[model samples]
Target: MTTALLLAVVVLGAALQRVSGMGFALVVGPLLVLLVGPVDGVLLVNLCGLLFSLLMLATTRGAVDWRRLALLAPSALVGIVPGALLLAAVSAPVLEIVVGVLVMAGMSAALLARHAPALDGRFAPVVAGAVSGAMSVTAGTSGPALAVYAVASRWDPRSFAATAQPYFVMVAAGSVTVKLLLTDARLPALGAWGYGGIAAGCVVGLFVGRALAGRLSPGRTRAVLVVVAFAGGLATAVRGVASL
Candidate 1:
């Protein structure tokens, strides 16, 4: 029964990631921790995330915007080092609360803003990428930061997904590296099975999400963004409080 529940969580997490480019960790991490343990849950989610990133890259290959990614990617890389260091030192519970508050606040701001300002100028992506990278180490959900920048840049869905792809891939790699270096933390056998389930879920979800992305009107897209932002924020808050 526990094994079945874990598998179901992975599937659901993958579906969430397929639609939003993220959320697997938010959905699966906490539950996995509850069922297994924190360390095991983190390992499982990270592995699944790595596979998911590859799948997303393949699915959105042709549509990627190399230009924006080129601008933002370096900053993300730079930020990850510090983030990794911080993660090594800080307590998980504290990090969770901080991240949760930020998520909620960011969502609130985005929703309340009257106009989406232009953030595509010279330094915005760099700043956003750096922040996203740092946040990834702690929260594993830097998609909100990237999304805000993308929205400001006026990137269409394909370009947004494309530009963000490598960031996720790199962040996942950085996270796994950090985890391996810190301790003798080994991936669980059960997690290996979970990865397959998540991958299958992501594949199906991606197609559906892509189709929905095409049909969404601008207003609807904005609405979705607002909702996701709030969800991310709420997840962060819950994680944070739980840590406390």
Candidate 2:
């Protein structure tokens, strides 16, 4: 992609992430794949996602639930390696298709199970985080798993979105680390000019997204999250099919 086009997508994606709390990858991953090919694009997506969540946490520190982060983050860290290994073991296109189908199915279930029993007991968060981490590495998204947790527990949207910032920060960072260690892929250099463009885009996104976020009600936030899930699922499915 042209430098301007790349910046435009990043800015828009960063804004969506800021507004909805979990859409940077969903909004930008496919486009980046088109721009820079799949592997490099995914690396950029992971890096940009980490940046987005860092800024989010800086702005909304008080809302972070450390207790939750404690459970989710470590589990995610552990889970990423296995997820990467799983990807290595499986056929890429087939695995991606399966992952995409499962994501869509999971989203459907979450929608129906909104009124279903909330998860409890000791290992619930562990399971959620582990699954989230696995998905983050394999599919370049862990948002759907976290989204179901937020909805099933009936968390207030703002609080849920706020808490998710830290989770994304950790998961994105961890995924990048694991991808670096386990895969042959190394992140492509952006150079000084590219970095500057990214920085400017982030600055613009932060301002625009915060302004838009103020307008969302709890219901609307949930609505937006649901839309993000569908988009993520569809994108994954398309990538799978296209690869085939």
Candidate 3:
């Protein structure tokens, strides 16, 4: 029953991510933590999120801005080392709460802010990459930081989604690698069924999201998705607080 529920959650979350390029963790990360315990949940979210990005990138390769990749990917990789070390020191519950709060706060701000500052300066991408990298490693979700930068840059939906695919894939890879190398931390032994479920959920969700994405208005859909993500983040934070 638990596994089935988790699969359902992943399907929904990954579907949102498919359309938005940023909602997978905000939608599913917190609940996964509650369902499987914090460490395993974060590991699961990162891996599954990575898988989703790979699948999305497969079809959207042409749309990605190659120039941005140069600035964003390396900084994110550099950020992972410190984030993993921080994860080692922090308690699971505290991390969960922090992830939840950050998700909600960032999404809310993105929605409420009518003015998006232009990313014209040379240093803008660098700062965005660093913050995104830290967030990705520590919280298993880098979308908010990327979202903020994407908004500021006035990127269209297609450009944002395509550009984000590589960013997310790299950050997740670096984060997992750091966690494995620098400390005793490891992905919980979820066995074959767990891995299978994650793969299946992401594949189905991605295809579905692709099919539906063309039908929605990007601006409106983005706002709606943020609202949903906010709700999911709230739930995760509440669970974390309740557990404490």
* Candidate number achieving the greatest lDDT relative to the actual structure: 2
Q: For residues 1-244, write the lDDT of model 3, one tens digit per residue.
A: 7678768877888788777777888777877777677666777788888888999899888989888888888888887777777777876557658867876776667656647565566577777788778776666777776776666566676777788898899998887777678766567776788778878888888888888788889786666445655665676567668767
Q: Could you say which candidate leads in TM-score?
A: 2
**Can you give the TM-score per candidate against the true fold?**
0.84, 0.93, 0.86
Note the Cα lDDT for every prediction shown: 0.68, 0.79, 0.75
Q: Where in model 1 is the C-alpha error above 4 Å?
A: 183-185, 208-211
Q: Residue by residue across 56-131, what tens digits does model 2's lDDT show?
A: 7888778777787788889988888898898778766676677778777877877888777776554877877888
Give Cα distance to truth, residue 82, candidate 2, Å.
Answer: 0.6
Q: Could you tell which candidate, 1 or 2, scores higher by TM-score?
A: 2
lDDT: the better of candidates 1 and 3? 3
Error at 88, model 1, angstroms: 2.4
lDDT (Cα) of model 1: 0.68
Off by over 4 Å in 3: 90-113, 228-244
Question: Lowest summed lDDT over 10 consecutive residues: which window, candidate 1?
Answer: 105-114
